[model samples]
Target: MPENRISRAKLTTDIVLAGVFGLMSLPFALMGNWADLVAMALFVSALAVRRLAPAWSLGIAWCAATVQMAALRDLQFYDFAVLGVLYSTAAHGGRLVKWLGLVSAGVGALIATVYLQVLMPIFGDTSGLTPENLIAAAFILVASLALLVLAWTAGLLARSVREGREVRRREEVANRERALVEYRYTVEQERNRIARDMHDVVAHSLAVVIAQADGARFAAKTRPDAASEALQTISGVARGALGDVRVLLAELRHREGGAPQPVLDDLGELIEGVVAAGLDVRRVETGEPCELGTGHQIAVYRIVQEALTNALRHGDPGAPVEVRFDWTPTGVSLMIANRLADAAGGPGTTATGATATGPTGARHGITGMRERAQLVGGTLSAEPGGDGVFRVVASIPAQPRSTA
Candidate 1:
């Protein structure tokens, strides 16, 4: 049999019953009514263990019934313990035990009738009953059986009602849990949308400004004319970056609507901006361009944008950042790699020049990149190499929208 767990409330109820009914038995015990005293103990045991061990409670009640009949003790008010036992049996017992309780009810009524009519006359004072009083004895027997059946049947009905209530309560709790889960999912979706917009605006624009500033420094040494041209590029790029940051900030202040996302067509402008800032960077593209959906295109653009941004912030300025794309009919594969900066850090300066977690540590930049990949039905992993190279690789799956 499986073990049934009982709650603290139920155990407390059993303890209370044992105390109340155990004390109630004292009156009978003092009167020298051994049968009533014994019945009291059995009935209290039934009440206490009804939920915990219903079968055992039923057996104890039956033994109490036998003692009362065998002693031919006159029925006392405490004899109501029989009805309490019968009710508990139906309410709490298993299938076999409930049926046994019903049978015990019938047998107990028979024994009660026999004791009142036959055994009392032989052992104790008969009072008014005699062998000649056939009609009276018959009436008594019928009424006793009726009350016994009523007690047992009442318990069965009560059990059915209690079980129905329990079933309804459980369903209510399940519905509440499902609603909570759906609400959390909706909140998460909205947060991700806001995050994607902010990442695109901040990371891409700053990468270009940093690249231009670096180039101006290098050109200032060799050619004054070239240095002047680099300075102009830096001024224009910084204004554009500032404008993008303002737009993202506005979107953050009012979350009801969203700003436009970027796409693959923007890649050239993004890379050129990086080159103007002055990093040694190269771009490689292979295979015919496959048409990607807006969401997938945004994912591809943002991932590349973030990778390039990180490269400028953490890569050695003298080393080249290789951005490569291997496009196929089904998907686009991207790889970006550059030599990681030594403990000295990169030569680029940004609006937020905080690179404490640069190439080797944790940063929000990596998290945003990974989220973008997942949004596009892809996987991304960026790892720092033992050989001082940091590489980010991603594969984004897409199907031609005409087929979709």
Candidate 2:
């Protein structure tokens, strides 16, 4: 498609050039009578409106030229006004206009050179073909060709500038789109991470509280003292849940707040707490003492805690649960696996202080655990083991992890 804007701009410049050239030619035309002066004025006035309508301007200039030629009975150098019109047509007009303008410019130059050199040879008495006249004709032809080349070059430069600006605008828009996409991706990842952490916290805490509460209610008649102890354990578990939640909330505000940091070393105490609710837990380790960072230590502690809670809820009652921690040269690895229950546990009941089943298979609890492991530059996998047993295994690097 043609660029109307470029066409319009070139047309405006054409009109201005026509006006300046026409006015400059007036002094020479005015050496004649009042008729000549008035005609020149009218002709120049028409140049101002060339851009308003290019075809009309060409007609006007042509008609004025015919009148001027008639009154003078000869053509002068100023007869080249039509050349300006031709250039405008080639530069800003249609394809048909361009071809017509080029032909007209060439033909007009030829006729004017012939007329000036042969018919009206004012410079010399001899008017026939001569070396001087031939040289003048050659120069005029060359000048016309130069003008054509100039107009074409100007048009190309204008088009190039417009395209450059357009390309820059597209690049800016692409950059903005890329930034927006990255921002959305970061937000989604963060939301998933928070969801996983919340699932682990709520599921483990509620499971422990419920299990203790159930045991307390059942033993109230047969063993009143044991039942009171179960109640006390439930209260302690609830308080600990509150503390855990508070610590998590503080973390959201960029503060750890001197909260008690749980680590692998605390596994025994954690297991004892569950056993206090009348559940059996067996702990095992396969590594020497290793110093772990604060955040990673908490992460490892939570992993083991969540696993034991899961076993309590779903594993065989009175069966054994194995908790293993292996510290290797590369990193620390944790595994928690329990013997499966032959008979399904009661709904929402656990003597070990845990839920009978997790939120559903595709829910966030287990998925959260896996993500937490990954966040610390670790890997976690949970699935069915042999003979109805479920296993949760995690390997987290001991080196500095990526905070992001």
Highest-lDDT candidate: 1
Per-model TM against the reference? 0.58, 0.59
Cα lDDT tens digits, model 2, 93-181, are 56665566566556655665665665556543655577897798788667756665465445445546767988999999999999989
Clashing pairs in 2: none
In model 1, the worst 10-residue window by lDDT is: 343-352
In model 2, where do residues sit more than 4 Å from their true spots? 1-130, 138-148, 218-282, 288-302, 341-363, 371-379, 386-388, 401-404
lDDT of each: 0.74, 0.65
How close is each model in CA RMSD to the real structure?
Answer: 7.6, 7.7
Q: Candidate 1: where is the Cα deviation over 4 Å?
A: 1-81, 93-100, 117-150, 160-205, 213-260, 265-269, 275-288, 291-295, 311-326, 335-358, 361-393, 400-404
lDDT of 1: 0.74
